[model samples]
Target: MTAARAAALPGSEAPAGDERLGEILRALDEDFLAVLGWDWERRVITWPRQHPVIGLPDCPVPGCPLAITVSTRPMCGGCMERWRGSSLPLEEFLLVPKQTSRGTGQGPCVVAGCGRPRVTVAGRLCLAHHVQHTSAGLRVLSLEEFLAHPGVVGHAEFGPCEVAACYLKAVSGQVPYCEAHLNRLYRARTAPGFDEAHWRRTDKAICTTREVSLRGMPERLVAELLYGLWVRTREGFKSRPECLRPVYDRLRARQVQQLEEVTDPAAHGHGREQVTMIRAGSERCAC
Candidate 1:
């Protein structure tokens, strides 16, 4: 059948919810159907829908979610994949928020309360305050823009070495360090070393060990064992000494309790035989 006739036939209509139909129409007008060897109206309408738009339309860079126009040549996955190695103008596609003025119609300052032009991540202060303030509030810089700044130096916040540290900064979009350092400090001070297998084993042993003398076995020893084991594990190895302090304190308290019972015969005597039997069994079983 003729292209126009084919295009008008039943089922030769655009699918529902296809917003790009206008673009498709433009393509058809430009002989796209002729190039694909299909009747313009029929083929265009009859083409089976295969792919759906995937992922958010905004920039995938962490902390950035501005809806960038597809036609404005926004940075896509391919661009981001090679972003570090190349110096392409990816920032050109970045969507900058519009600056709002005060009721007086004057741009007082980008930052609240401060009457200064916002500083770039590179520590570039406005000409008026450039020499006056060396250390100002933290500047919000893009990954590329931050790299381009002369004074903007990257600091490592986690991992075994410097490279791992830099990788964290690159991924987190934070200024000085990544979130891992903060998490490590917080965990160290607040959370106990819960992942050490040896710690758990020793804890179990301490709970079950029954010899009256052994019953009063130092809690410090158990704690030390836990801390040591934690250090040996991957999580422990990464943990700072401060993070291990709580574990140390817990074990120390246990040691103190054992010592107290040992010194006071009355506290530990009644359970002595039972404790002994339990300890004997534990030793035999290698628990």
Candidate 2:
């Protein structure tokens, strides 16, 4: 059965009359007894033959027949259409008397006393006000014009970040930068003749430690030694190796010590014996 018809069946939470009416119509041909509460006398007397005898129980509008389906208002379609065209608020349209207005399809913008029609954003402000407060590019700056500039800026009200495709609002109340970018700007300001490339490389070397390995140690560690191993200067260590070389050398030495502990006779006899046996076999089969 269709949803409208099913909902009209007995015990549904929706208005019972419409759903009940739909249910009677659906069951009329298949089960006459079910439609008439299994009363055979009522079934024969009230069943539709040439035409349906069932009519709406009550209608609020005087002398108006409720012929429209359950989905629409409980009045005739003609009355409902006239009500829609009237100036009444949409929520209370079905309950109130018809109102008088210019009969234009559109309504006024949401801003108070702004008589302009809401053509740009329905039920919101007009295009001019939207552009003035939120985005200059919305009206003044075209796509080609904005593309000329590397980073797009917004009007004071918009307050979006400078990075393309990032909609995060700028953290500083008036400045162009967000909290993260603002910190970088401050860092640059404090540094004397800061080299952007050098700083970027140093920052990456000092901060990154995920899924990274040193030459001797296979598993990744929490320390930044992994970055020092890969990012190297002409002297075979990262520039300013004094800052990181000590940590890298210590970790490498610790790894070697751990390996030695595993093979030492006092710890595991099998490890030392295996190495000794392998060396002896290599000597016997010298090619």
Name the top lDDT candidate: 2
lDDT of 2 by residue, 71-180 (tens): 23555455667766778665565566433322212334444444443332222444334444357444465545533434433323325434221223354445544344
lDDT of each: 0.29, 0.34
TM for every model, in the order presented, reads: 0.18, 0.15
Residue-level lDDT for 232 in candidate 2: 26
Cα RMSD to the true fold for all candidates = 29.4, 34.0
TM-score of 1: 0.18
**Residue 100: error of model 1 in Å?**
11
Backbone clash tally (model 1): 6
Q: Candidate 2, overall lDDT?
A: 0.34
